[model samples]
Structures are given as C-alpha cells and as structure tokens.
Target: MSEGGSVKRSRCFPAALLAVTALGAFNAAAQEPPLIRFGRGFAAEEQVWLMSARPELTPNQGKKYQLKQILFQANPERFQAFLAGELDGGTAPGLAVIFARAQGVDMKIVASVCLEAAGREWFSTTYMVKDDGPVRSAKDLKGGTVGVVGIKTATDLWARAGLLNASVVPDKDAKIFPMGFPGMGDAVRTGKINAGTFVEPFYSAEMARGGLRKLFTAVEAVGYDHELLDIWFGEKFLKAHPDTVRAFLADYVAVTKYYLANTAQAKRDLHKAGFVRTPLEIYLKNADWKRDPAARVDVASLDKLSKFMLEKLQWLEKPVDVRQMVDESYLPRQ
Candidate 1:
C-alpha cells in the first residue's frame, strides 16, 4: 500500500524531471495513508468512538492506515453500505451479518464490538412501552404498533421474534414502523406508537423523564445471549491489507482495554471528541455498552442465532455457517 518506499525510474529520464516526479510521488505517497472507510452507529460502540477519542493508544493510526468513518443512524443502512462496497468494515449487527452472507457477500467477522447477553450487567437494547399503557408484554401487543430503527434490523428482528414466541404474528398481530432513536421516547409517550426500541443516552434520558416501562430487552426477546454487533472486513480488503487490518484491530482492542480501565476519563475524552454532549456528570452516570475487553466474538452465539433465523424466524433462505465466516487473525493476541 505504501508503494514500497521509493520509485525506480529508468536512466533515460532527465535529471530535473526525474527528481521532480520522484519527489512529487514520494510526497503524495507520504501524505496519503490507506483509507479505511467504515460506518458507525451511535452510542457506546467504543471501538469507533474510543479509537478516534484516544489516538495515542492506536499507534498505527495515520501512519499505516487512516480512517474515513461514515456515520449511520441505524444498522440496516450500514450493512447496505458494506454490501454496496462503500465501507471496508465497521460495527454491524449479527442479523446483518447473516443477511449479508445470505445475499452472497464475502465478509469476515474480525472482532467484537458489543454483546447483548441475557444476564450481562452491561447496557443492552431496551424496548419501552408506556408504564400504564394497555400493552404489557409481547403477548399484549395484538393490533398495536411497534417502532424500531428499521424493518429486519436487529431491533425489528427481536421485536418480531418476541411476538412470535408469544403466539402473535409480527405484521398481523402488531405493526412495525421505522424511525430514528432520538424520537422513540416521544412516540411511545404520546401514544403515537404503543412501544419502541430505545438504545443508550436516549434510553436513560427517557427513563429519567418518566412514563416508560421496560417490556423486554434484546436478550429477553431473542431468548439467549448473542453477538449484538461486531467488527467485520470484506474478504478482498482483508487479503490485500492484512497487516494494516491487523494493526487497526490491535489498536481497537487497546482502546477497549483503555476504556474499560479508565471509563470516566474515556467518557471525558468522548465528551471532548463531541460524541456526547451531556454535562460531564450526566454522561459519566450513564451505563457503558457491554464490550469484551479481549475483542472476542461470540461466534457460537452468532451460529445459534443464524440457525434461529434460518429455522425459527424464517428470515434466512439457507443456513449460514457463521464459524466459517469468522476470521480472528486480525485481533490482538490473547
């Protein structure tokens, strides 16, 4: 990617032209690092947020590889970007991973960003309904509307799975409407929608304002622990820049380690980076997303969910061999 240090020009070239061309090429090469175009969604996905916030922890950044992060409001569009060849890789939900595989995209899971384990104390996606609303659980949602980030997204999948488990058909028993996370609280509160998915900063803010009750978490809806979101790479990109990818992932894990160890400071850095805008005290009091310090992916959880989507949810056309799609070589050594 660096063009191997220097260029070799033929002896026939004029001295002045050769020097100018060589110098210009060298300077251009030096100025341009391999751009890692990736997409990121909001809140507690420290891999993207932390890496940019704490550049010192990522030694290879700007030298070996540069980042061109494209932000998305939700996960489905991010996956569309990856499949459309717009991003090298970034955080994506396990459902998106399987969906990509089903669509014949050759991408590999490189590392873990976060998990939605059932019993994990870390922050997970919470579906909220009015505390005194008529609907109480998945079973009570018949003829009601459910708001999510998008159809077939992780939130939508969980919402549908929860409904199915309760013997309520998704589209027939309850409707799903897509909207941005920022407005979910108001939608549920004003009775614009019966229930909706709420992730971080918004979740806490909405709860503090009162009038919402937790219907079920992502884990509870899906009925097990699973890889919620993970870092991934296109197969061709991984093959072309294995060292660059490895270095980026190494820094990625380092940021995770640094964040877990120094959360308050990390949050302060995030505040400074403009990722969060709350008063320092409020941001610090918010729960952090559950990230594995070692950058380990729950491939088994992915596999189980893959099977569930294929067999139970009828979301996938064929079985996805999640184990085969995983490539942990990019991660820092244990």
Candidate 2:
C-alpha cells in the first residue's frame, strides 16, 4: 500500500509543477504593458511628439503604455488608419468624429487638442485670398473655386459655413476643390484656385511669399470660437486597456499643460519632433490653437456644431450624440 501511494504522489507532483510553470508564463505575458499606436496631423495639432522630448512628463509612458505617434496631413487620413485598425487613437476634427460615429467607427472624443477661440488669437486656421487679387470678401468668390485640405473636413466645413454666412452659397457661388495646404497658396497665387485654407508654419510661409490676404478665420463660420480638432481613441482600445489609457491621458495632460505654459519653448522643439520642416523663428512668431490645459472639451459647442452638420451643411444624414461620444473619465484628475 505504501509503494502504490508513493508512486501516485510522485506522478501528481510533476503535473502540479508543470501547471505552475504554465501559469507563470501566462502571467508574465499579461504583465507586458499595452502598446498604444497614436497619430497626429500638423505641427500644432495634438503635439504628442512633445512627450518624447520630456520623458519625465510621462512616467508611465514606456512602463504602462507604449506610444507610437504618426504624422498625418489631415484628419481624414487619420480616420482611414483608424478604419484599417492601424491606429489606436489620433487627432480628429469634430466633423470627422461625428462622421466616424455615424458610420459605426466606434471612436470617442478623449480630450481637446486644439480649438479656435473667438477674436484674434488666431494661431488658428486662416482662409487666404490672392494678395493682389480683386477678391476681398466671401462674396468675391462667386463663380470661383475654393481650395480646402479635404472635402468634408474642418477646412471645408468652415469655408462652406463662412461663405454661406456671407450670403454666398458654396458649390454654387464658389466651387470647392480638394488640395493640400502647402499647394493652396501657390494655387491661389497662380489663379488655379481662388482661395486656400492655411494653418500654422504654412500660413506664415504664405504670408511671407507676398500675395495672400486673409478672407476670414474659423470663428466666422462657427459663430464663435470652437474646437478645431480633438484627440480621439478607438472604443475597442479604450475597453481592452483602460488603466493604460488613463496613464497615457495623464501624461497627455501634463505635456499639454507644459506646452501651453511654455509656448515658445514648445514651438522651438517642434522641428525636433518631426513636426515642422519650416524655420523655428516663424513658428515662434505664431501661436497654435488654444485648448484647455485640463483637456476639457466644450460639449455645448460640439453639440451645436453637430447640429449644424446635420441641418446647415447637410454633411450628416442623421444626428450624432456628441455627449455620448465624449469620454472624459479617462482623463487624469486635474
């Protein structure tokens, strides 16, 4: 009887040890921090690259969540990456955010990245006309073509709304053309297009080139200063790794606060982050968009903008729940 029991115990001991080893391997794999692949547009938007310059701001960045930032030209391309599941999160305009949700993209507005406030703090988007050209107002664009970074984008929406507000009908009084920001100024100067949408670094360049005049800014169309673009995260990613995202948001808030407080220094480092190809002096002279250091978004403004998308612009077939699309819980406590 002793020999039989001893043999049975030896056999079960090996099985128990093997199970313990397998469980340890599984736990180790689970302990690996989540990798967050994020994207951004221009030098001013999101500015996630700044985090790399100041690692101390993101203590949990490499420890809890890995960040990969992609530079995109516009929000549409960023959303394309989101659609292909290539990006976990990135900067997206309110129009694109609504369009994505309406089309079942499953994204949430995590925080405010950049916003155009009422008044001349522009550091925002600028709509420019030929400097020496006869076109001065939205009314002057009648029967002319207007260039936008992309159709159905913030630039397009603003241009349309701005023209309409001036009592000029878009696509009727002025035709909308899709083009890149860099080419817009040249196109306007060469007369291929009537006007172009301008953003930082590029806007300064155009102004220096000596032939573009400001027609209007984003505030003219939105009725007041509003969010131009915001940080968005895939709903799936947020669910799969909530704690990691929280850490990332905390880092984001820190860096943004740092950037807002030290605008000049932040712009100086813009080129270091692969954000600016232009000279640092120009970027220093211009400020980027304004955002809450706490990363709070204007829900009322977004809700109103979504309504405009549905009614005025006919950009949406149905209404989107802006409030429901915003997830502020992931933001670190201020």
Instruction: Say which candidate scores most in lDDT.
Output: 1
User: 105, model 2: CA deviation in Å?
Assistant: 1.4
lDDT of 2 at 263: 78
Q: What tens-digit string does per-residue lDDT give for candidate 2 at 185-297?
A: 88998999998899887988878878789998888767877877788899999999899889998988989888888878777776666566787777678656787888888
Off by over 4 Å in 2: 1-29
Steric clash pairs (candidate 2): 131-211
Candidate 2 Cα deviation (angstroms), residue 317: 0.8
What clash count does candidate 2 reach? 1
Provide C-alpha RMSD values for all models, in order. Answer: 6.5, 4.1
Give candidate 2's whole-model lDDT. 0.83
